[model samples]
Target: MRTRTTTAALIVAGLLLTLTACGEDDTAAKPSAPPSLTDEQRSSARAAAGLPPEPSTTARYKFLEALNDIDRRIVDGKDDKAVSRGLNQCSSIKRASGDEDKQVELVKQTLSRFTIDTRLPDIATPETGGEILAAVHQNLCPDF
Candidate 1:
């Protein structure tokens, strides 16, 4: 009886182990790429705002870097070079707006239209493009 019981226990343990191993996979989940606006989408957004489309990846990175800086500044309460870089990038948008507050508002609305909620730097939850754009405008365009 003892031998039979021991054998039964061993069999159960082995079966459990096999089942667990079978369900397990060695592959890791791939990280999703950052969401960005398409050229047409950007162009449409710009047109809606009465501004030209901003399609430069370099500008995109600068915008992202500025977002990063703005995020950092919010926490640390100090300005940095990223602030300037980001403002400089927005200058084109400002120029397109013809120095009117409505232009900035239009750009912001357009950004909101195109922005998606995804993993953004320093944000615990997914952030939107409008949120980032607002941050830049709020921080740099004080008059607006």
Candidate 2:
């Protein structure tokens, strides 16, 4: 009886130590924030926008890159999957914009403007999928 109790206590102690060590490693491995853009990149982005240079321009460029990436994916034939991802990206931009109606209006206007590019494969043209992605980039990166 004494030996069994000691073994049980040792097992419990080992489990507790393992759990504590696992949690500490996870916390240490947490990802750091994204790095800021260099001065040259920021200046070029501002020049392209034809606006004054500012720290926020970096973020705007990053945001535009994200939107464009989705557009590329859509054009690459990912179709619905790209649309789903783009919508999520748009939601983040909309939240940042604090103008849901304006964003929606811009998206609608872009969709109306671009139509589907017929050069793409039929699988890449899902009703208004092409237009929707164009709309997303337009609304998200109006400056660009």
lDDT of 2: 0.51
Task: Quote the positional error of residue 127 for candidate 1 in Å.
Answer: 6.1
Clashing pairs in 2: none
Write one digit per residue (lDDT tens) for candidate 2, span 32-87: 98999998997797465444334244544454454456455333554434344444
lDDT of 2 at 32: 90
Top candidate, metric TM-score? 2
Backbone clashes for every candidate come to: 0, 0
Residue 121 of model 1 has an lDDT of 29
Runs in model 2 deviating more than 4 A are 22-28, 38-40, 43-144
9-44 in candidate 1: lDDT tens per residue? 999999999999978875676577888989798778
CA displacement after TM-score superposition, residue 23 of candidate 1 (Å):
77
TM-score each candidate. Answer: 0.26, 0.28
Worst 10 residues of 1 by lDDT: 112-121
